[model samples]
Target chain A: MILDLHNHSIKSDDGRARVESYCQWIRKKEIPIDGFVLTEHRQYDDESDYRALEDEFGLRILKGSEVETEYGHVLVFGVNDDLRAAFDFTRIDLPLATVLEESGRCGAQAVPCHPGRPNVGLCAHYETRGVPEGVEIIEVASGGSRAGEDEAAAALAERHDYAGVGGSDAHIVSHIGRCATRFPREIRDEEDLVAALREGGFEAVRWT
Target chain B: MMVEFGDEFEFQPDVSMPTVKSFTTEATRMDFWRFTDHEKARELGGLPGAIVPGIMSQGILAAAIHRFLPGSTIRKIDTIFRAPLLVDSSPTARGVVTHVDEEEGTAEIDLTLVNEAGETPVLGTAVVEVARAE
Candidate 1:
């Protein structure tokens, strides 16, 4: 199964493409991916749209939010919709550890997004502290720029022996499927996807 | 002709200020960008859940300086982040004209970002090269 673990839709404050637009592009390009996860920013506001597109496209659609934490951004997957509502999108008081614990309690795996991008939100401490449990993967691809940060992140994942995932982190139609992770195992649900990531059975690929 | 260093020109704070809304609304919204994470921003001692992109603040500072130093271009600005500008927080760019060198065609400005609580989030100095009107 192939998965684009990191991506953003128009629901994100800075995204420029809608879910439907990406769906069409995916079909047009005949991309070989079994699932796509919509990791919107600040908050998760496109569950219905994601579900609709998933059903129409026969793709496994996962809903997740890139929760902004004080230490950095963590991708929270498998959280209940109700729990999402209670999330304080504007609060920056919680520590990175607390945020990770909350994400797990909410039935989501807290995966750190990009960890190296200059003055961007990279949890350098976490990287040095060693990979925490319940944190499944490291994002290796973001946008189209294949800068040294991604390479360094890839190296970090290898050194730590954690699951390394890649996604376009696409905010526009042109960026979907630009980078993705292909898993050898079949993923029937979100849990399966997480398991695949944790076991390191996926390969990161970039499509032209 | 040259005059005494301190007597040749005067320095004053630019009265015009740039609002937070003007910067956030007008400038490009940073998303999934590494340096602008809402969470990591906090860890870095930012008050908001996210870090206001330094560039955004820099742009606003540029605008504030533009008001007083007309026809001047920012040569370089060095800023130190004392505090993080949180999301949705209203911060204003305040500048004080510190030094003006007419012979060198330059002006030195001290810039700061003041939030609602009257705290300075960032403090820095910027040198502007002004093109005197012909």
Candidate 2:
């Protein structure tokens, strides 16, 4: 199954379209995908309305968030109420290890989003603190960043042997699916995606 | 000329808590985006100390543009985050006019948010309407 593991909805400060808007566009364009993850920036609150749209489109809808940690923006998938209680995500100064530890406790997979996107990226910061453990994947490609940056990140991921992923990082309707990940198995929910992330059965691909 | 290519208008933004508190996001209060605490900001960006938000710097630049070309509309702002603007030392936002079209009545401006140490934290370009004749 194909999933654009990253993108933002109207829930994000810079994003324009709502979660449903993304689902509608996918249906209209007949994009070959089973689902996509909505990774809102610095926030985590998924409404039930999104699930209904998931049913309507016959596609799985997963919840994720692009958290602005002290180091950089980190993409966290499989968030749960228990995990939220353990960590304060609203603050932008969360330490990198804290986030990963919490995600681990909640069975979530935390990947640094766009590790090469300038100041907000974790790639340079990694030079200071180095890559932490439990980080099995990294976003080597992002539609929202520079092309050279994405290529450089892809090379870094290759060198580190970290499973690479890609996303459109879309803040609007037109910005969807410039990059995506193809999973080897079908995913019906967030649990499956999390498992897929850990087991390593995905490949990052770019269309635009 | 008053409006030469390298001509610039500069101002120091008020970083006081009360003043910054008055500035809110387009959507919600979002105070965390504005509040300045050196230790926290340093922890956030791994910088030297307390630094202002890049968005807030952009906001100050937008305000400067509106003040310069009164009653004019700002069309676009292309900002590239260069460094973190330290908060303890006063930071200045400058708008340098690059090109002006007499007939079009539009101005192309380059902006820099620089700290007291002359470090430019944010560099951006703006397209704005200079003015129109009656």
Tens digit per residue, CA lDDT, model 2, A94-185: 88888888998899889988888777887778788777776678897787665467877877788888888988887655456678888888
In terms of lDDT, the poorest run of 10 residues in model 1 chain A is A117-126
TM-score of each: 0.55, 0.61
Taken over the whole model, the C-alpha lDDT of each candidate is 0.63, 0.74
lDDT of 2: 0.74
Regions of model 1 farther than 4 Å from truth: A46-49, A81-93, A121-136, A144-146, B1-134
Instruction: Calculate candidate 1's fnat.
Output: 0.00
lDDT of 1 at A197: 62
lDDT of 1 by residue, B85-122 (tens): 65556676776544456778776565767666654566
Span of ten consecutive residues with least summed lDDT in model 2 chain B: B19-28
lDDT of 1 at B122: 63
Candidate 2 lDDT, B12-107, residue by residue in tens: 888655555455333236556325455665677576765566677788889989877777778888676755665555778788665666767776
- DockQ each: 0.02, 0.03
**lDDT, model 2, position B3:** 51
